[model samples]
Target: MQKNKQWNVKGAMRLAGTFHFLHSCASGCLLPFLTLYFRHLGLTATMTGIIMASRHMLALVWRPISSVLARQHDKRRAVVVGSLFSSASVVLILLLFPSEGLKAESGRCNASQLNANVAEDGGEFTTLENLPQFNATVYSVYNTTVVTEQSNDDDTAEYTPTPLISNSTRSVRKVRSLQEEHPHSEFLGSLKVMDAQHQMFFLVLIVTGFWEFMAVPLEWTADDGLYEYLDFVDATDRHRSAKIWKQLGAAFGNGGVGILVTGLYCLTGTTAEFYSYAILMILTVPAAALLPLYLRKRERRTSGGFKALQLVHGNSQALLCAVTVVLTGMASSVVSDFLLWQMQDHNATETHMGISLALAHFSQVGFVPLAGRLARFLKYHGWLLVLAVIALSLQCLYYSFLWGPWTVIPAQLLAGISTGAMWWSVESQCEDIATPGTEKTMFRVFELLSLELGAGFGSLMAGFVVQKFGLSVLFQGTALILALWSIALALLKWKIPRQRRINYSRLLAADMTEMSESDSDQEKDWLETAMDDSKQKNKWTMDKPSK
Candidate 1:
């Protein structure tokens, strides 16, 4: 609790907020643009799906490989190298290829014997009249494809691309000189070119992923640390009492931050001169970096009626968290991108978009604290969960049927509220179900994994939706999926009981000494009552009621 109170308004909290901002901004910028770009390349539906699948596979491979490399080498340098290479590849392709609808650049190679008319003296090989000469043949690789059709020594025809470039998947061609090049001559310089016209396009994806890998650790480290180092210890009132106030304060502050983000988004609409997305990414970094420092710097003990973190991590919670994590594990570019496009289609002006966004974020303010109060809030959590699910279902319907951008904004706003409520319920549910001696670190990982799973699911759905009915059809499909999602969650919500939840958070907190009391006896009693309520919501402990 002391930690929470101190962290509420401090530098560390601000850092956390900043990190969230950057993460969102970076993710938001690319998600909206990448899909639109591939369509521009004239890629077919099958090709697009293949590309999307490759990216997801790469993301899964890259993270673990990157992690292993970081251990053996300098982490920062490795990040820099990966990012630099990724960026350079894009820049190079863009500079070289003029974007005139996939023009093919080609050149012809010819060889002629050099005519050396030597003077009477052997040394005078360079006579003015018969200097060795041959015209350097030049052909526009940009116009015609390579010709491999069999013919006489002087014969050639427009290259009918063989069984290659037909697969339609992105690939770089690498041909080696094994048997045929003349041994005495140096290898003819390779006319390196990609099969597809826009080689720079896929590079955009690589650059984005590389940067995300670089940025993730910058913020997640602090988050991961909280769960690993602090979760179990903070389960008790003695150490955590000060932190609950901070958590409450954080809830409000986070809501305020959401408001601020919306305000900024509105102030600078999508078509404005500024790179709005990039600006958001830059601003978010510092906000997230300082959360840990702020937590450690405060000087006073915290005293207040604050919610306690539940200590018991259970099997159900672990399973849910793990599933969520796996779903979200790979990079989620598709769904995120589709959503932005969906929003933009609704004529989301800069300022108007922010309002919707703020609505979405503001809905989250109370959920976190409510999760903290889970010992008492458990059975009731099911109700909130149900409510959120219903709202989510409504959101999908609204999106599917709504014609105007104006209509969609309201649905988006509803999404915000549903998103917050659902997340909070999940958090609390996990705490309620925690097993004995569950570490803070493990809890944090579990939570993140669930989010990852959700994102991945969204990503998978996005690719198929666009290919099937185009954008208009995609909205309807998204609605149907979300409807299914809501129904499933609602059924599960019915099974969780509130009284049991309160026992877990409430009594567990008291047993652990996490409550903080004021010096005054009356104030102390009030704090005790609040603690009791907190325990009731968070604990779900029904073995035996405290005397």
Candidate 2:
């Protein structure tokens, strides 16, 4: 029996970890690439931010509803429902409103390439010699015209009608009529072919982001369930091992899929990449369903109250941590949403972008387990989180000075360390602080209070910043905010007593036993009340008979 129970626990962990991996595989395909997709639609940075912010905004509401359900019913139910909703949304959006803008840049040819291809058609090759390589300015937009005129000492003019040029997602075509009239014109400026595609893309993203947020709470719930299962199996200290498994899954999921998506884009083209991502999101539902099957059905906690609010008010450290997460969220939103565009600006190809992201996530496969070991040795999760914040600040500074596309590779090491450690430490701290019966509630509340709220405001703020000042200023400003947040974290560490901080992990292991005792005590009190009521009724019956 003992051996069987242990095997069951191990099986549960593997299943849960696999689920985490699949979900991340889906996210890795979409989240980092969404900015580029939006740009393909000709939507501005501000509009992208609004779509991103909508997810976090809806998450704030979902957390509360999911928390209530978890407290009132089985936590697994919420997880299952969220997965189904997310799967449906992804499918609907992909089938009904596919964006053509992503396809515009797919295998497009530049003016020089077009000239060479045209020459090849006549069994000749165009040489680079005497080409108007210096005088011509290439404007990339679809259905736009460019006429180039060359002059010699004879005062004779030669006109060259440039083929369509596509730099990124925008493409332009030359007008034959305009080129004929401007035979002597030296240069023709860029003109854009405007359409309703950008607006259509915006509407689709908003709807898609909304459905995605609906599933957010379920993922959190599933993760917490795994941790609680470890505690139940008397493996609380080994919780990091479970997290390591999750990270490993994410590493494989992200790294493997990223490479495949890039490969597919090169082969079948851009439509292949978008459809592949949609399929990944759909796969998340079945993988997510597997998680709930292994989760322990939690005992119901008392429902309906401002537990989240009370937690913030009662715990000064928690409040400070929440504030820091807001800054962290603001910083993260800017980097995750715009980093692709930055890479593109530095002349990175789709394959290069995919590889860079894969490298970053793969780097975490090693760093996350190491951070867990370091946290255990230090015996203080709080300081580890502070260090993670310091790492974030450094990465932000690095991004501010970004010159080459490869520069982002080194910064990703910082990303895995900071983000992975911060989440692990924060969840552990929440477990320690929660009252005996309200563990999941506390975790969910803090997650929303810190991560979601911060992410939401950060996305909104990033849009406005990108619009007004520019992308470079956004990176610098994020670094400055992180620096300030680090100081605040330092102050929080100083104010909170070391003894109190060290006692958290010890207290967490006893929460279940304490809850059991509390339930027994409540049962005893109810029995005593019922016996007293029976005695009073007997006395009243005897007195009435005598009268």
Candidate 3:
């Protein structure tokens, strides 16, 4: 009985759900916190953006290789390995967390010395503009010294070493003079200091990206595996059910983990928040290992990962889909990376920021099911994309003019539409059009490409914009892009030939029917062969009865 019930379609879905939930918990810990952590390290906006971009940018090289490996090896094993690496990366990030504080301490020491000098000068000016000029006179120090001389005949005399007199001019006055000579010297100086500080954090950023590249694909494979398993089992409402479970997991991760981490951050403070992240990442490893056990034998069989290539080429709709996905990603990155900053900019606490994020994720509980229902009606599969555009644009606009920390709650509630609807639509459409053996592989490839192009570039671009402009400009610019993209999508939909708007649901139903018939026929053939063999064995036994 235990053997008979070892695994089933429902069991596989449950496992997939578990994987998503744990994965979300791990990511939630990082997403809202990591960028702020960088800022806390005294890293400038550009460095923070670079770190965010690098997380996805590195996937460019690893994604293809990872997909190939998952196809060639056991995807479960691949995911387990990725989880272990993720855990390592989290621990390393935690270890490096103290470096920021140390650097800050060093800066404070420098400031203290300057303060002492100012106090000694008895300067009364309180502002940089009204600060008095320092005298440029050189200061000299003299000390007694003894000298020894040796004769040409190698005679030596003993002597005591003493400090030598020295005279040096302090550069403070020169720096002030230079400041007067060059109006932009302060900015230049700051830029130089920022460059130097970046050198220290660069390695940390690279290490952070390492696990992200590894874990993201592994998680995608596992997540997509569940959907593929549902298809293999010929489950009813596969698309909707799979998305519901996935979103449910996300809701749990985002709401529960988001609040937990936020509370931890507030309790332990920003400097120690990495500890919470590391602990959460450690939990993902065990969760990932359970994925393979849920898959049936046939589902576990290897197919080439590169099989996705057939669908990617010459598919115009898929191409358009990619464009929209990229736009959505760019807009989403602003919220994920800097929403906390925006909250703090409004004088909100970390707890308030966490609540806002939790609200966004929790809202998905309501919309994911709605997306599933909407999918039942749309034959073309593009309606969800439309919803995604409108919702995402609205969310971006809301964020652009966000009034308070509490405001993020509404913005994130709108976010549920974008995340739930877009993710469901993308996965469902890709699976709907994918070739039979390439569903899993195609999902992995598409996810990597879309996220890297969209979110990666978005973070990098946002960083540069934030550096040059400000956060307000960044949000407004992002909102404008999304708004224009939405208009473009509407126009594209209108231009589509009426005949070309195919009925995706009918195609999906036909595909399911064909698969079910094939399975039924195979089962019938196996049973008939078994009965014939049993009859032949009985005849042979009767023929040998005389013995």
Q: Quick one: best lDDT, which candidate? A: 2
Per-residue lDDT tens digits for candidate 1, residues 1-547, read 2454543433433444445444444443333344433433334333444455554544444543453344334343334334433433332332232221221111111111111122333321121112221100112232222332133223332332323322211122122242135433323312233333234345544554554454444333334333322343452323233333333333333233334443453342112211433444445444433334213222333311111222223344334334433432221233334544455445443234434444444445544454445525544554455555566656655655655545655665564346556555555555565444433334454444434434444555666666566655665555565556556655654563333343434453563344454333433446668988889977767656888
Off by over 4 Å in 1: 1-198, 225-335, 343-355, 366-380, 436-439, 442-448, 488-547
lDDT of 3 at 500: 31
Candidate 2 structure quality by residue, lDDT tens digits, 426-527: 776676566654665665566676567888888888888877887788888888878777887888788886433334445444445546766746644555
Q: Write the per-residue lDDT of candidate 3 for residues 1-547, one digit (tens) a residue.
A: 2554644666766665666666565556555677776765556677788888887777766766665466446555566556656654654554544433211112123433222223333312121112222111111111111112122222211211121111111233344467788977976543332323454466568677765765655654564455555555566355445455544544444455445544554244453445545565577666666664323444445554555655655466666677788788877887788777776666555567666676676677677657666877875567778778888877767776777758677777887788778877777757655765565566656666667768888898888887788788888888788778878886786675322324444444454454677674564455568888999999999889583
lDDT (0 to 1) per candidate: 0.41, 0.61, 0.60
> C-alpha displacement of 300 in model 1, angstroms?
30
What TM-score would each prediction reach against the true structure?
0.53, 0.67, 0.68
Q: Which regions of candidate 2 fall more than 4 Å away from where they truly are? A: 1-7, 70-198, 224-242, 266-269, 281-299, 303-305, 372-380, 437-440, 495-547
Among all windows of 10 consecutive residues in model 3, the one with the lowest summed lDDT is 134-143
Deviation (Å) of 308 in candidate 1 = 20
Candidate 3, number of clashes: 0
